[model samples]
Target: MALRAVVRSLSELCITVGVLIVLFVVYLLYWTGLRADSASDDEIARLHKQWAAGPVDGGAPGGGTPEETGGSPSRGQDTTGDGQAGGTAERGAAPGTARGTAPGGYRSGNSFAVMYIPRFGGGWSKPVLENTGKQTLRKGLGHYTRSAPLGAKGNFAVAGHRRTYGDPFKDFPRLRPGDPVVVTDGDTWYTYTIVARPYRTLPSDTGVLDAVPAPVDEAATPFDRPGRYLTLTTCDPEWGSSHRLIAWGRLDATQSASEGKPDALTR
Candidate 1:
């Protein structure tokens, strides 16, 4: 009878252990994602508030607007000889030739810009924090520090999780060539056109973050001059990080935030 009792107690212990394991899995998969979403929302709200407040003359924390800084239009604006509004001109620098300058130097975990992918959905947008570290990615997409600044003449690369955390790039695989990936620095909307299909590479590959992402396929070409480019990197295979998937794009247009949402964002 004593031996039987010992076997029954062991079975109960096993059952308890199994239950705790399941609960831990649930916490990692669901609770962490909820936490990430809440953090991202808070960061975005803070950025909007800063932009709404407008910048201080030359000493503002977020920097001044293009007009105040003597910079060109964030996006191309068209006007006839009489200064009346004309339709958007071809995607190029405006007469004064100013592009969206970096907001200011940001710390590792601070959000500096917002990203919108119309291909994902009209409502799809994410905060872009300054660093690619684990903590920054958990809050939102992480901008690679060595890459170009947003709306500038080099590869503006960013990284995000594919499945866990908020799964910011869960739909990354659905992006196709010609799709629009738009970014805003609170003052301007910079639209990028996806140049080709996503290609897979080893996680160790850093060329994907080059000034012009090295051509992966026939669709890509090396850019000799300074040109606005973008590169998105995420883990492949949905649930693992054995490799990375990359998508490339080039700036197609720029518009003022005062003009309202860009056509890529509209229905």
Candidate 2:
């Protein structure tokens, strides 16, 4: 009789432990997402406050004098090469007015820019923080430290969580070729078009962050030489990190923030 009782007690203990393990996984998957959403909201609020207070010294690099619209200097022009002349505005300088210098040194938690993807829906945007560390990514997208700054003649790469931490790139797979990925640094809006379908690779494949991402297929290089490029990265399978999904884009047009939001944001 004692042997039977002992066996029953062990079985009960095993079931309790199993239940607790399941709960922990649920917390990591769901609770962490709540925390991340709250963090992202706070960071975006901070960035807007900064913009409203006027441009910060050593703000984003690559700003230049305002562009000429008609007879006077305007905030910015639609340099998209599509012949759509953006009207003048009372605020912000034009693209290329500020030279592309080294971006100011920022710590891990600082919010630097706002990224918009039209294909993600008209209201989709996320705060881009300085570093791609555990803490920073929980707030929003994390910029790769070694990559080029926005609108520069190199690759500006960023990473975000696919399944947790606000899941900033949750719909990454929905992006199609020719989709627009727009980013603004308070002064200018840089628009990049998706060059091709997203590619998948092992987590160790760091070449996706290269200045010019090497061609994945034999359909010619996306951009022949080193020009402004943007790369978005996230983990594959929505819940696993064994592989990575990458999206590539090239700078297509630029406008001043003062000219109003880009069409990507409006549509």
In TM-score terms, which candidate is top? 1
In angstroms, the error of model 2 at 126 is 1.1
Query: What digit string (tens of lDDT, one per residue) describes model 1 on residues 75-116?
Result: 222112324233234212232333335432343466768999
Give per-residue CA lDDT, model 2, range 150-232, as digits (tens): 88888999999998776778899998889999998776899999987778877877877889877444353466788899999
Model 1, position 189, has a per-residue lDDT of 93
- Model 2 alpha-carbon miss at residue 7, Å: 3.1
lDDT of each: 0.75, 0.73
Query: TM-score per candidate, in order?
Result: 0.79, 0.78
Q: Which ten residues in a row have the lowest lDDT in candidate 2?
A: 71-80
The lDDT, on a scale of 0 to 1, for candidate 2 is 0.73
Provide backbone clash counts, one per model.
2, 5
The list of candidate 1 runs beyond 4 A from truth reads 1-6, 56-104, 215-226
